[model samples]
Target: MGRTVRVIAALGLAVLPGTTAHAAAQAARPPRAVAPALTAPAAPALRRSAWTGTWEAAPSGTAPALPGAAIRNVVHLSTGGNAVRVRLSNRLGTAPLRLGAVTVALRRAAGPDAAPGTLRTATFHGAPTITVAPGRDLLTDPVPLPVRAGADLLVTVHTPDDDGPATFHRQAMQTSYVARSGAGAAQDESGAAYTATTGSWYYVTGVDVRGSATGSVAAFGDSLTDGVGATTDADRRWPDRLAEHLRVRRVGVLNAGISGNRLLRDGTGPSGLSRLDADALDRAGVRVLVVFEGINDIINTPGPTATALTDAYRTLVARAHARGIPVVGVTLTPYRGHRLFDAAREALRQQVNTFIRTGGAFDAVADADAALRDPADPQRLLPGYDQGDHLHFNDTGLLAVADTVGRVLDHRFVGRAAGVRVLR
Candidate 1:
């Protein structure tokens, strides 16, 4: 009845003496036919939805205006994507700021010019040009520019109107190019027209890219986090180094540090508490915060106590937790030999660090003090890491701090879906 039995009967093979009837029948049957192979389905296309902050510089103060001139700012991106957008600020400008043109391109090197065939023009609401009012920021429409992590982007803006007081980040260690009024170099691929160089970033504040990343981490601190003592044009800041360490991971590192920034009151820039929302929380896809402030408040300012500073830290932690982003507290480094160092300030620094280490207030602790402090003279920085200022770290010190932070982040976030609230 079955196919095998029919084949065996038709073949007429004799049954062996030792073999069973089923085995003899199967041996006489013809081979079975094989089924045809199947084709696999094509993979679905990925959707472009999430965006991350690839590069950022918190606007600290106002820079001189570039009336009828083109200014090009070079920024280092922490993550790459298929499309890019830029955030420009007139936060300190007195009058409306008008722009004639705006362009973004991938830089071939550290200089002003972009690589050929990689330049792209950015638009705002489908318009080529826009006017930004005082105390406001404008985000350009997404431009199709493929970028790799750690790529340097040259953003050129042509200002036709007199921008009164340009909102800027004053401590950009990297050099940027500028063309005078008569020299229009916004679209120049060869950087020949850019004659002047500056160390500040004007107008542009942040750059966001569409990518598959979990989110970004904002380094909220003062000059040490701002890369003050690192060499010019070298992306050796602790946050820059952290970005490099996290390039293969799905995370972005944004440097929101302002030189001389204080945690308690306004100083070189807005206080850490005042600008936390704008600088850290509101950034594109920011998931974590790292606070390395309070040194300036303890040494340079008055009316700050250990209790007050730790209370301020508590406030920062609470605020970030409300937005579902964890905060990592960094222990302040030693500054015993600096001009501002005093017994009272050193005592306060020790008290605050004790609380940071044992109080269980922050979600994580980076222990920067232990990493950079001298073993012989615990109240001062290690001789090799010190930049001679006693307060800031050199390139080597910066790398050490970055490595510690990177390890902490990796242990907390990588390969884990749920966020961890506390890390020693």
Candidate 2:
């Protein structure tokens, strides 16, 4: 008999900022003081817990097609949060955008299972809001919030924002619709919290607690792992599915994938290497890390740059390891006949994959390529799992990626996921 151990990777997509060439040059500062020492003793054998969830905003009607601001799944917190982090996007925008008064409050309940009308309020570094420029991501200064898990929170924004045709992963977990000013979500209640408005319009994608996490995993990579082209509102992104897997086994998963992102240079989103802190490491309770990146570096960026890409990856691996957190390298999936197919690019991908397979620098490695590649085509997605784009994965494809990592983390795939503890 076979056993399943679900595994979750807190992956971030390629979130690029729309900074001007001049601004980027000026803003580039040295790596912030080697991230404060997060030295923890060998992790105890403990079960997992649902720690945090991600949320983004969807564009509303007549909302200026801000090049990078058309984000789907905006999030709001209510009732039980103190210190919260808001995700400011520049993923698809062309120029840097700035945000002003971004507020969080309780929305009125609109359903049978609604909580209460009045709820707790959140602070932006004890102020009202902070600013996030394009092509760049920012983490707000932690604020003392008082909220619990599963509470409804309202995240509001008003600013001189740029717009663009952004890409979003639609899922059913808990995303809202976006109107001009309000996110069409159930009104949040405090005393009698329950579901109210059934169908909401704001794209309030995700909201999660920051207190319940034991540790986190950063699954950084391109679209194949990011769950692109999957059903909207299904939450079928491999990371989402992985989170469910973690719930069963007692773990926390954070999704940080951006479509069209690369490891070496910028692609559709910000370069994988550049968005590390915002996407993965900087979170309060981060522990393990899984890097499933580099496909874009090989296939999309400057050709025949495998050596440079490898060197950059080495730097990334070294940085994470220096922090005492284990870094897991995932092999790149094959892209045999996509429009960007190139023999040279394919060669670079194979080289990087080879390094991941044999590179001892990584605490562990997941052979993601073997999990989804066709036995015959080898370079193309396995039959029945392709999203038809030949670049990204379908729901089935996402599951395959999850399964591969699941098995790599723990011999089991379900019932008892990675970091599981069986109580007698």
Candidate 3:
């Protein structure tokens, strides 16, 4: 009874106004315990992504200036990634090229219009604009836009000042739009402001994706690889067909072909030897190189001899080997009726083709000749394959070339990356 009375007295002191009474009651009470702080759960590890080349156009040369105009280049991609980025070149520019705005968006029905919500403004090191120096190039910072394979994307470049000799790919074989008024129409989602069309690609050269693609295959060659005879806007280039075939492998195909390109020396663009590094070996995730050159060299006079050509092939292979990249030697295809065809040229072409097939100078060979040649004539393109030029191949012929490459690559490098080469 006395203890209960003491407890009641202590409770009464706690309620009292005086600090002395409160202190006495507090001192009499047991100590309170502290609760442990709550800990946050650990975060999951981020998935790693690699930059892969899904689409590319090697800069061929320069075009006239397009000052204060926004040029929208429509590019068809081979593969896709989680995010996207683009490469613009000034490789042939005589002066600095200043870009006011660089934007990308999904195309709406093959026009300059962007899909409802896919426009993305690309920055250069966090700045929305960039100035590329002469004989130089720039890559945009990655945009957080998920892209898909086989998408037709619009990469628009707004040049505030004269930006030419604009680094360009001469034979785009696809339609692109231009807004001749000013830079304000660059990011415009509607196609209203774009009133002009072109058959070449300017400023933008390559499209890279942040995704799981292992690497890319570069189709380095001439008009055959550049789709000279294939229908424009149809994506019927042999390289394009090759991309569709490569979709399952999660690999990309980059067409580095320039129409009239040659093997030993420069003509339409830099010779295969001159541009190999930039066009193939140094490209993003380039695991293999497929050279489909030599046709123009054979057609054009002052051409290399069979020995000189094969020796050049040896040099190209050696250089590619230096970079740990294997080379594939494609046999030179037949050209019997073209204006430049002659007995000597035909014999020389035969010698080169023979070497390509058995010289063992390359890591692998994709016999575009066997696939494109007339079994009946052996010295001419199969009639259906020929684009009436006896040299260039039509869409069906492009598919044939693509199939030949696909077959050899599949056999030699299925589930892996090996070199590829094509002859046209």
Error of 3 at 57 (Å): 0.9
lDDT of 2 at 43: 29
Query: Model 1 segments beyond 4 Å from truth?
Result: 1-48, 416-424
Each prediction's TM-score against the native?
0.86, 0.66, 0.86
Candidate 3 clashes: the total is 2
The whole-model lDDT of each prediction reads: 0.78, 0.49, 0.77
lDDT of 3 by residue, 359-389 (tens): 7677778888988899989999999999998
Ten-residue stretch with the least lDDT total in model 1? 34-43
Task: Count clashes in each candidate, considering only residues at least 3 apart in sequence or on different chains.
Answer: 0, 99, 2
Q: After superposition, how far is residue 172 of candidate 3 from its true place, in Å?
A: 0.7
Kindly list the per-residue Cα lDDT of model 2 for residues 74-128, writing each as its tens digit.
2333212334555544443444445444444543443222234333333344554
How close is each model in CA RMSD to the real structure? 22.6, 10.1, 23.1
lDDT of 1 by residue, 42-143 (tens): 112222357888888988889778888888899999888888999887766788888788899999876877899988878776777877767666678889
